[model samples]
Target: MKVQVNSIRAGNVIEYNGKLWVASKVQHISPGKGGAFVAIEAKALREGNKLQERFRSGETIERVHIDERECTYLFKDENGFTFMDKETFEQLVVGADVLDEDQSRWLQDGMEVTVSLYEGTPVGAELPKTVVLAVTEADAVVKGQTASSSYKPAIVEGGIRVMVPPHIGVGTRLVINTEEGTYMERAKD
Candidate 1:
């Protein structure tokens, strides 16, 4: 399918320069001196090479079709990540290289995720936007640091460090944005 440059969005797979690329970020630029165009940061679907391209308004690009399947994350082993199809219960093992850094850390057991397959092989994955994570270690609020809207570095359930509000303390269960690794809110649990 052909889609207008302005219509491109993150996660959209587009064909450019005779190569298949997945749009990771898209920005619409409207400068005072020039016509509008879309700036895209795309990664090659097969080779994982990243590139930036700009397309002028009214230009159309080919959109590649991908097959997505709903799967439940099982566990992470030395071999790779394992998942079971939600519908068929069939298991699939995917390599770590296929997932970006954020996805690798945020993936939790039994969490539902979308696996994108190309030519019957797993090529990509879509993780849930928000996840509940327990704060493992949060620095004690320094007396003077509280004067400003300061944040403290803390480690979460996955052993990844993130900047959190000063009030957040150890053992706090907070809602986290997996993509940005930012704190959203305190978890109800």
Candidate 2:
């Protein structure tokens, strides 16, 4: 479907010049002396090559048709990661590269995630907004360190190291922001 450039957003798939691209970032700017313009950072959906393009704010652009469905992670094997279509009961296996850093860390079995599909081919995986993980190792809280405000590095059960408040200890369950990989707060047991 063709839509105005101003309507595009990051993660949107678009078609231009007979090629499919995913918008990595987009900015709409209105200079004080000129007409509004839209700048986009996009990556090729098939080749993974990146490019930057600009257009008049009202320019029409083609939006690629993709199917995004919620799926529950079933498991992973030598073949790749597998997820079950929540609505169809069909299983799909996506390669490792399709899952970026943040998604890879939280691919727990049975976790619900959004999988983007192009022509029924899995293109990307989206993780939850936040995830709770158990800290496997953390530095002990030093006595009389009440004034300390610095975060310390700690390893979670999955070996993902993130900074947590100094007061946190091993075996503590904590909620983390997946996008920033930062500690949110202690998880209620």
Q: By TM-score, who's the top model here?
A: 1
Candidate 1 colliding pairs: none
Question: What TM-scores do the predictions have?
Answer: 0.90, 0.82
Best by the lDDT measure: 1
Q: On residues 42-149, what C-alpha lDDT tens digit does candidate 1 reach at each position?
A: 988889999998889999999888888999999988878999999889998878877767678999889999988877878778889999989999888888777798
Assess candidate 1 and give its TM-score to the true structure: 0.90
Native-vs-model 1 lDDT? 0.87
- The alpha-carbon lDDT assigned to residue 142 of candidate 2 equals 74
In order, candidate lDDTs are: 0.87, 0.86
How many pairs in model 1 have backbone atoms within 3 A of each other, for residues 3 or more apart or on separate chains, i.e. clashes? 0
For model 2, how does the per-residue alpha-carbon lDDT over 1-189 read when each residue is reduced to its tens digit?
999999998768899998998886798998999899999998788888888999997899999878998999999887778999999999989887666566688777798988889998887777898888999999987777678688889998789999998889998999988877889999987
Clashes of each: 0, 0
Candidate 2 ranges with C-alpha deviation above 4 Å: 4-7, 24-41, 52-60
